[model samples]
Target: MTGSPAIPEASAASALVFVGPMAAGKTSIGRRVARELGWEFHDTDARIVAGHGPITEIFAEHGEAHFRALEEEAVRSALTGGAGRIVSLGGGAVLSSATRQLLRGFPVVLLTTTQEAVLSRTNLDKRPLLKDDPEAWGRIYAERLPLYREVADQTWASERRPKEHIAAEITAWFRANHAPAEPIHGEAKDEQHD
Candidate 1:
């Protein structure tokens, strides 16, 4: 055991993952948390968009199943990188059983907001699923609540509060609970200054 490399006390899935309905501010809040923690940040939806195209076009041309497949791959790539960071999943990412399974053992947070809040918060025209049927988001949220709760280690309401506050609270919880005794890989970047 002499001169052996130090083993990580935490798992590869130790990164904090954010999940919830659309317009729940997961990306913004997760970015803030990453900045505060000095860790990397990845938004799975953005990954998908970058690799393929706009989500609306993907849904229209290839359909939901195809898009979900791409989304699953994005989730996998983000979490399996063996780094402690913040990852914001697509709103419908939890609907994939593979994604849900991969989320196990990871620090997952669910950001919940009312349908009214979501409607008033963002543009629906860009949301493919909600463009023609904005009310469908409520039903989708209801249907997915159980899955969200299943993977979420904690839940935070994004309603009537600044995203910075939510990110700070989540970051505090992460520091108190899941912060490694030391850095798992290397020094976390000072993302705030960058």
Candidate 2:
């Protein structure tokens, strides 16, 4: 991904976290919301790529267990950065209890898309889990849906809507329910370009 402007500390710290199943438009919508809010957008998956190389490579080299550890670390760093940014997490990021706890008090939105939509948006070959069994993708989604619902403060279904529309919905939700709060732990600064 190309670099974007660094988000203000205030915006970064109060970030809206997006979580959901694969191809649910989390990353795309998150980016739109961040752009609309004039805040920074960061994807934990992207950070993982920046830190440990591509996800496929990580899984191939050290296996999923190692990759998950890296994902957890990336999530922790994004949370602790204290920027009111918009963070798009990997589909399985919420599988970790630690990650869920870390998201407490943040505006967490879950993007829900249909199975058909998911299958259409994702590449079967690139996804490690989906490559094996014909039913693996469906199985994984069914298993993870409950967990996603459990952690989400708000949920948005994005079956056929444009990403911008979904992002507008998120922004509307934020305007209505979000209460601006002072930075927790106060780690504000203009860092180098993201």
Give candidate 2's whole-model lDDT: 0.76
Name the top lDDT candidate: 1
Q: After superposition, how far is residue 46 of candidate 1 from its true place, in Å?
A: 0.5
TM of each candidate vs. truth: 0.89, 0.84
Among residues 3 or more apart in sequence or in different chains, the pairs in candidate 2 whose N, CA or C atoms overlap within 3 Å are: 11-84, 12-83, 12-84, 12-85, 13-82, 13-83, 13-84, 14-84, 15-84
Model 2 ranges off by over 4 Å: 1-13, 179-194
Name the regions of candidate 1 deviating beyond 4 angstroms: 1-13, 184-194
Predicted candidate 1 versus true structure: per-residue lDDT over 85-184, tens digit per residue: 7889999999988888778778899999999998887799889999999999999999999999999999999988988999999999988888877764
* Position 23, candidate 2: lDDT: 75
Clash counts per candidate, in order, are: 0, 9
Instruction: Write one digit per residue (lDDT tens) for candidate 2, span 1-194.
Output: 11323334444337789999877888788888877776677789888887778788888899998888788788777866755577889999988876776677677999988877777767877777776764676788889999998888998898888889888888888867873654233222222334
**Deviation from native of the Cα of residue 87 in model 2, angstroms:** 0.4
